[model samples]
Target: MTFLGVFAWSPVSSATVTTTLGVDPGAWNVWRNRRLTPAPLSRTWFRRASGSPLVYQVSDVLVWLATKRGEHIDPLTTWRLSLARDFGTETSDPVEIRRLAVLYARAVGPVIGGVRFTTAGFQAYLASLLSSS
Candidate 1:
């Protein structure tokens, strides 16, 4: 259930996934949520403002930039850097390749859903992090 740079995780302490979006839309109270759209999964909103979870069906989509190491990933980066291209082309070593694959998944989730990196958002996000470093 992973996307370009996001993990398809269920609510682990109210972790959520969202779609059918527009504006803030008041936390899953929109028609799409009410109807329970099948095409996209819904979950409670991770209230960034309050730093809490709110019950609702929403497209509260999250983009994880991953916090893995030079050769390690915890939970987010594996999804963020997911996909073959997200995987570095260093060596065909199974271990190295697998590590890259995991990193790919961590770095990028279903932000694009099998779609290649065709948006400026991902690149921009990476640039922001690098600049901060």
Candidate 2:
């Protein structure tokens, strides 16, 4: 998903971001500042962690895939599914669990955007991946 950078910004630590998205916060900082291209979509307040240590909200990491991107869903459904697997959330049988994961990921995978992203998806995705592979 693509954000126009108009959403509310929160004060989150890099540890929170890494714990959720499994990516180093430094990469996001570099990419958001335009130093890198086609990196995960994240919106940050500052470019570098010069003065104070950087902080990141879980939403910052999810905005890349959950927000709108051009026309398509940016990372594609397959990518989302793969991400779910990698994160340990399988999209297999058992309609109830799969449905829950889908709903969770669609809502923003283990984080909150406008108070929507939550840990439900995080656990679901992680669980799914573990069972699948």
Candidate 3:
């Protein structure tokens, strides 16, 4: 005698997953080097102002430089030096110097940080003084 048997079939399913991670050592080195290096003076405004012949140009630039380096500059003394440099002792007018000294003292804010001066006011004052002279 012979016997017959039947079997059922079923389908199978599968899935795949992938992941990646990496870092460049050179990038870390560049970042570290940048952090350790001091910042260079790249101020374009300062460069432009340096070329001008205004009475306070030199003093303004000096005060700006001092402020950038976290220091202070005496505005009165700076103004005096600037005047002397721009106009030698032989040519410097005592009355004009005294007037400018008063203007500087009025415009200067304090002795702590960066000195402040009103450019328009100073320019107008200078123009008037020169026109009168």
TM-score against native, each model: 0.22, 0.27, 0.26
lDDT of 1 by residue, 43-86 (tens): 21122324443332111233221211134333233323332333
Worst 10 residues of 1 by lDDT: 56-65
Model 3 is weakest, by summed lDDT over 10 consecutive residues, at 9-18
Query: In model 1, which regions exceed 4 Å deviation?
Result: 1-22, 36-82, 88-133
Per-residue C-alpha lDDT of model 2 across residues 12-112, encoded as one tens digit per residue? 44444554556676776776588442332233323333354444333333444444343333222433444354456555444544344355544553443
TM-score of 3: 0.26
Which TM-score value belongs to model 1? 0.22
The full ranking of all candidates by TM-score, starting with the best, is 2, 3, 1
Candidate 2 global lDDT:
0.40
lDDT of 3 by residue, 1-133 (tens): 0001100000000000000012243443364367522121223212223333112223333454467679876434454555564445332454655576545434432210121224554344344433321
- Which of 2 and 3 is the better model by lDDT? 2
Query: For this target, which candidate reaches the highest lDDT against the unseen true structure?
Result: 2
Error of 1 at 65 (Å): 22
Query: Residue 2 of candidate 2: its Cα lDDT?
Result: 22
